[model samples]
Target chain A: MKKRYLAGAAIAAAAALALAGCAGTAGGGSSSSTKTLTLAEAQKATSADDFGGMDGLVAAANAEGHLNVITLPPSWANYGQIIQGFEKKYPKIKINSANPDGSSADEVAAAKAQKGQSTAPDVFDIGTAVMNQNLDLFAPYKVQSWNDIPADYKDADGLWYYDYTGLMSVGYDTKKFPNGVKKIDDLLGSDFKNSVAIKGDPTQANEAASAVYMAALQSGGSADDIQPGIDFFQKLKQSGNFLSTLPTQATVASGETPVVIQWSFNNVAWGPAAGSAGNPNWKTVVLPGAGLGSYYNQTINADAPNPAAARLWEEYIYTPAVQNLYLAAGAYPAQLAAMEKAKTVDAATLSKVGAAPKDFVQLTADQATKAASLLSAKWAAAVG
Target chain B: MTALASNHGAGATPRRRGARPPRRPGTGWIGLIPFSVYAILFLGIPAVLAIASGFFTSAGAFTISNFSAFGDPVILKDLVGSLGLSAASAILGAVIGALVCYAMLGMNPDGWLRTIVDSASSVLAQFGGVMLAFAFIATVGNQGLIIVIAKQLFGDSALSSPIYTVPGLTLVYLYFEIPLMVLTFMPALEALKPAWGEAVATLGGSRWTYWRQVGFPILAPAFFGCMILLFANAFSSFATAAALISQGGIWPLDIQRALTSETVVGHENEAGVIALGMIVVMVVLMSAYGVLQRRAARWGS
Candidate 1:
């Protein structure tokens, strides 16, 4: 009796394992069928193309019922509010956001790696250089408010458009440097010894590259030439003023990195938080005469799992209400100028973001590509 | 011959001389099926893919330029840097760990102190990466606890030095390397027989002479083997260095850049080539280790 029971148990276990394997294969097979919406139909659609205009797009998106977004940290540009607001507005569509803290490179990598799968990202928030390099991966779909986006910020083919801009600024602990660094040239002073830090490798990080570009502009170099910036950093390293470290809030508060060169959005968001942590004198200053602005672009995946939902997301982000949400988070929305002109922007939010600098220069895609390659080839050796 | 003799003595028995016994069902070679499947799925396939990709371009065309990039000065510098760091840490860990093992040998092996030390060494040998980096930062970073204490006591910036530089990284690498050394080198230390010491003494050899001749020669192979392991461990380490160093210029860091950099074209194959280079280095060291371990095994048998 005992032997018979053991034999039966073994057979049952084997059957269960076989069933589990079959279930996994079946589950994987079903995901491909879930992509009922087509990329071609979505790309061609405008307000004129559809009967209900934006409402029809929303209806079509609701039918699709899901969106896969990637590399959106909640804290980044107030993505938390944007995502929450989006979901609350469109209760029918569920957003499956992957890798909240992942980098721009990670977003590109995921789109490439998971090309045909349901888990593939439908939207990307990436740097301009990265977006330009992987142009083939993005689909051409102009949002309803496409004309409002600046001419310099959008692709000619409607593949990608700028979402928000971050101006390069210096964030410093005021307790350490009572005089404060108001300009890029001020960083070279004797008071900032072994204190200054950039965000990360300029070759990889967009903010760090922009910081270098801002430094170049201040030190008599054009956007076409980043050599002066590299030279400046080398000089700083030679003078024992530049720390080859990535700065964080903790590092700034601890005096390990008393001064940091990063995006205005990041500095503005984190400066007050760092001050509240212990030091109450943290401040961020936009360098005078060096107001360089770089924007992160948004693109829909060419092979997005939910085509209608992805288009809907792009449409939602370009609206005046959402643009104000970005402004409130310390980022200059790509549609800020247009919204202000239309008197659609929230006055309170605009006042809080402060006045836009008149001479802020945006890099062309070609210039950005060239500068990125230059930095990749030269930054390491120059800094070291 | 014995079976044949037994058969002969039995006379007229049906059992034939030198005939094999019946094998058990579901045993013998069949037992290795699961392990073979595992090896093929995990190790064999990935290694084959890594090598195959190294010889191919991103467009699937064959190219040798991937391997050719190994000769580039920047790549060569990174490779040398990795080698130097690994060698320095491994040699330092091995020497210090051997000393520690010798000290442990003098203690009662079954004691609570021995038990605690052994357990701690095992746990610490596996400790590294992000947590270890954060731990060091909290304890010895620019505004770390020790630094703050030093500043208060001495009125000088004694320990305010940056802990993210190359030398600092070497110190971090040693945190696990020394304990790993203790774990790997202890058995070899225990393998040293007290009888050999007595024999050397009986032969009128001094303790110093015994150690220089018999002791050093016997332990040399195992020491070298452990050092090679430590070297491979340090060479292939990624997370600790990645977490600490922001601007990566080391071998693993360069490999990371090649694999992940958006601006650099044709780096996918280069990443495979760099990986292949690391495998070659590790294989060479492990081959040396295999030979030494085999030699050491002779003494055990």
Candidate 2:
């Protein structure tokens, strides 16, 4: 009888704790009593219109008090400043950024694994390839500046939208190639023997895939057909100029891989990082006539535990101030066209990054998917 | 031969009957609860889930088509490459580790040298993944320290560097494999009783004759079992090779490519199929190891 009493008491205590958890997530702070929209309503909000206006949305989000973000490395494209800028603009909310070095796929997996929990990521910044495959996982929330975004750069329903992109460029040790590589085919020369490398396997990584697509453009293959890119790599390998090593700052500094093909922003960023590491004379060049650009997409997790804060974060990042941060890091923002037209872009930062390539190609969703499949089918055979 | 046969018979029967009491059936199983729970949670459930996913399509419909990944020439090549690498590393590791064990046979167990070797083996066997890959890169990579020295002595063409290739990977695998071999094969080496040598000498046998007739028979199973264990260790290893090789040159890397490819969708279940294949390979290897272990144990006691 005494054991049964203890068991019953334990069950009651567990039930109380469970209820407390639900209450904590749903409504905790004193300000939540004045919240116009419930957490459920905020989760379904497609725009601030659902909360009457942006001010109402702000109040609801402030009540929530916490936002969960994943896979946004602070160093990438000046996210560190953007995050700090958001915190300064919204002091009431605390942003929790987890797994800052995780990949796009890892972001999706974490969201799925932590679905309804308060710790679940409320937002995602993922590559377009992964974003296309996981449309159903995102909430269709349009920011207040949604109309300024290009029609082709976002989903019709605002499920996901382009954030920033960098032109695919070649970064090399200036000591090795004094004249600099003026064209993609320069990598095939004898001086570059066993020296050229991409960021990762083209079949898997976004940056490496973009590098191949850039090669495809130069080799007379369209975005829908990337076979020429494979042939180009095979030819380079045959000439003993293609290295399979994944190039990092350390490897570049050590001269293990003298030339790396990746994003212009990344390579430009590497000029400073690798200089500090050892090698001081690093240079990046966006080869003319073959500029390929790809953008990462941002979206709200459909099952966000802090839904109001997720929407508020969307509003925060899309602002002109935050978009200019991408320029400072040598990347072109999705709103570059709009900001240029409105004369709101940061001109000094834009000049430093140089002009966006006049004749660059950004593959549509369908084109990228087709290109990806082709790469998956043929990459290992071509370069294995 | 007659003396050895008599000794074996005398050693086997009476001890089997008298040494071990019949385990109390139900209560004795209580000790296995924690292990059983751990296995079920970590191993058994994940294995079942992974293998089951291989038989299903992405939309949850049942299908066997996912197994077709094995038929891909690329996958077949990866499998062959992985198996050959594992075999090479395992055989070399076993031989070198066995030699180390042989060298240590006459050492005092509590001596500083033996203690350091034992502790180092225990630590180095667990040292792998990114740290090991970085160490090798810093030591023998294209522009590494040894390569720089060699380049100065002999022209650049004298030595073809192998730091990022399969040969280099095999050499790296041996770093830990040799140590593991010492830790595992030492017991069987120590099990060689001094009395057995004395008995052989008394029977007018030479040292080589005693080894050929007795020592080889007793130690062969244990040696092969440890070699198989090392093979499994190399087979399942991923991070070290992944850190070194960018492309999918092995089974685990292939699985990594299938699952995490940013552009490839609807092929995630192929990772499960590949995992199932690995499990099948492990099951066969472990079964052989079990049989070898039982045989070795019989002789050991």
Candidate 3:
């Protein structure tokens, strides 16, 4: 028995050493390929709600001198964009940033583990579901533009608020949506049945979850009742038109999946980029309809070790000029006035990517949860 | 074997009473302390936490709800699916490994066969996760090397398909498992002497007679042991499945199911339940083999 145990121990040690070595050598984001936000992409805020309380927060945070913000992306896409512009504006603070994988529950657990310590993130760009789950960890503060956000979106206690959303912009082979259908009903036609695609793992995504929430709302059930959402996938499955997974960019332009339920910016980035050779055939199709979008939000960590840097980053990312950088990069910005002023979210881009006016299916926390569960199960069944 | 126990006094007392050879002093045992320490830290602590947590949280009451969640069809299906795949991989691995071992044994020891087995086993052992995925894709994808070659040979209809299906997943797994199997079972084969086969053959015995009397009796325990190891390795793995699924996260779907569960509270239960069963099964098989090995030694003496 001792000999056997010893043998198992030896095997385990050798394996652990190999795994540790492999892990160190691969996949970690220490390269120039790592994404960072810059001041050049920082758009200025125009809506009165955005700049409202930022100055005080920035001043408070700056007195501390150093800031460490650990948040997830879309915000990571340009946390530095509008942020460093503020650093240029202030010149008193130093910042460190870490963008953990958004889909990892472990990363969220790690942040919870470090909540009160110096290592805790000063800001959290959390998902809708988790933002509410860890609300207690944050130190709540209402920003200047707090009122511009709907009461339902921001925490009344001011722990966190909506920063931006990754709505499902309908993408189609412009070759197929020739007249360019711009509504949810537009997707039901024969031309787009098997052609539409969805990201495979919707359970981990805020946007995908929100889409199901939208479907429940649009089809007459409250978001709290997600039977409609389940039925939605079931119908798609029975129709034999369900293409459940779409690669981020490669599949979109290839016309394999003509319509993709994807982020606005991914479509914006690749919509009509110089194709691999001459020009790719497909184009983007943005549809405006009820229950067709998901919002990826940014929220400040209330108990930030570096509240100044967190606040500074908040102000930096909310500006119009910087917001346009995101627009240019392929994401829709939260600050509408800034985007309008910059005139970068072009009509062509909007037609290809933005949600149509009057189609928002706003949901509360309880409703979002119920919708997430029902839709995820139906999605599993659908994929199966 | 049953008749032998009645005659235990023949060799049993002498063996039991005789002064056993002192274990080779410092025969690699001291080199194992770090390994023991690691097992306690990683395998021991996590297992303890999991079992303890299943009973009660640090703060309060006990709950059997984690086990109850297995009532869900999805959970049960994942458990069964994982077992099925692991068993399949293990059997597949053992067969391929045995065949390769037999083939290599017949060849000259210093020949090309040895070189091929050496390099191939090492390379296949290292092939995992994304690199494994890429290798399969390069073989069977729409734009893969084989598909292109086949298209020129056959036609465009060949590209209109999925080479990454469930069958394809099993094939990819076999690619690695067969090599690892070779790595695991090769030592026993190397230890085997040609004299055993020739001696039995000299008595005018047929091949099957020799194998039954000499080959399998000697190597059956080793091959079976290695098969169980293969099953355990593949069963516990998450990454290869994660990479292979069609934009999906993991195969057996259990790993992804575990990851996406809102509460981690019940995850260990479902995964641990299947894993714990595999461990129990493996322990039983190995124990039985150990007993058989003792019986075989007694018979040989």
Tens digit of per-residue lDDT, candidate 3, span A105-219: 4335445555654445666666566655555655555555555456755667666666555445666666656766565545556555555566545554555555455555555
How much TM-score does chain B earn in each model? 0.85, 0.90, 0.74
Which is the better candidate, 2 or 3, if ranked by lDDT?
Answer: 2
- DockQ scores of all models, one per candidate: 0.25, 0.40, 0.15
Displacement of residue A258 (Cα, Å) in model 1 is 2.4
Give the alpha carbon lDDT tens digit for every residue of B162-275 in model 3: 534334466677877888778766766776676777888899998899888887877776677667666655665655565445333233355444434432222434444434
Candidate 1 C-alpha lDDT tens digits along A131-198 = 76678888888887889998977887788888988788888888878888866767788767678899
How large an RMSD does model 1 have?
A: 10.0
How displaced is residue B293 in candidate 1, in Å?
Answer: 1.1
Candidate 2 lDDT, tens digit per residue, B124-212?
A: 98787788888888888767788778978887532435756655689999988998788778888888899999999999999998999
Off by over 4 Å in 3: A1-100, A104-107, A116-119, A172-197, A210-246, A250-259, A270-282, A325-334, A337-356, A376-378, B1-20, B23-30, B50-62, B148-167, B246-256, B259-301
lDDT tens digits by residue: candidate 2, A1-384:
122334534643554455355555545443432447776777899998887688877877877777778867665787777888878888987787777756687678778766876667899989887877778899998999999999988889989898989999999999878978988888888778778889778877888888889899998988888888889998987887877777876787788888999888777777764347646878888888867998888899999988988999999888999889887778898999999999899998888789766668888879988888788778888887
| Per-residue lDDT of B225 in model 1 | 77
Q: Which ten residues in a row have the lowest lDDT in candidate 1 chain A?
A: A27-36
Stretches of candidate 1 above 4 Å error? Answer: A1-52, A253-255, A273-280, B1-36, B157-159, B263-266
**What's the lDDT for all of these models?**
0.75, 0.80, 0.54
RMSD of 3: 10.0
Q: Which ten residues in a row have the lowest lDDT in candidate 3 chain A?
A: A39-48
> Evaluated with DockQ, which candidate comes out highest?
2
Least accurate 10 contiguous residues by lDDT in model 1 chain B: B4-13
